[model samples]
Target: MSIYLTAILKSKKDKIQDLKSILDNMVLNTKKEEACEKYELQQSLDDEAVFIFHEIWKSKEGLDAHNQQPYIQEFVEKVPDLLEKPAEIYLAKLV
Candidate 1:
């Protein structure tokens, strides 16, 4: 089954640019990832605190591999300090 993830992030005011850069890198890397089907980021129109992310992978292994990627590893290290709270992630399977 395909792997799906929806993440909600709250950006800190001082880290807005850093978060944007991270998202940009993620977008580029995910497009190049072999098993990626879709990976996208969307900003909330009404709430400056909100960032919405969607990810799709060919399989659970693909998702796991994506998590282990270098940039993603770096992001994991950097993200906690850049956000108002920990990112809220939900895993899903297609109906």
Candidate 2:
């Protein structure tokens, strides 16, 4: 079955633009993966520093592979300094 993921990221007050640029690169690179079904980046209207990633993959394996990608790893390594808090991630399936 397809796997769905939602990740919420909150950038530090001064790092929002930098975080957005990094995330934009991640989105571009991630969408090229063969197992990726959908990938989207959303910024909150009420909070400029809050961003969300909505993703769909072919299967759990696919998502796992995605997690291991270099771009993803780079994002993980870089986010701590840029974020206000730890990212929140949810894994789910379509109802």
Candidate 3:
């Protein structure tokens, strides 16, 4: 079964561009994964500091593998200093 994930990330003051650059790189790399069904990044029109990700993975194991990726780890390491708060993530399945 596929897994759906949505993540919301908020940037710290003056860090929108920096965070966006990182997110853009994430999208670039993540989309290349064989198990990635979808990986979309969107910026908020109302708030420049807010960014959102919509993703679908082929399986939970695939997502688990994605979490272990070096690029993902790098992004996580940068989160504390660049973000306003920890990322808010939601998981869903089709009813």
Please provide TM-scores, in order, for all candidate models, with all chains considered together: 0.94, 0.96, 0.97
Question: Tens digit of lDDT per residue, candidate 2, span 47-82?
Answer: 999999999999999898988999889998999999
- Model 1 over residues 7-35: C-alpha lDDT tens digits? 99999988888898998898988889999
Model 3 residue runs over 4 Å out of place are none
Best by TM-score: 3
Q: Model-by-model lDDT, in order?
A: 0.90, 0.95, 0.93
Ranking by TM-score: 3, 2, 1
Per model, state how many residue pairs clash. 0, 0, 0
Model 2, C-alpha of 20: deviation from truth (Å):
0.7
Q: What is the lDDT of residue 20 in candidate 1?
A: 87
Which tens-of-lDDT digit does each residue in 1-95 have in candidate 3?
Answer: 99999999999979988988889989999999989999999989999899999999999999999999988999989888999999999999888
Looking at model 1, residue 11 earns an lDDT score of 96
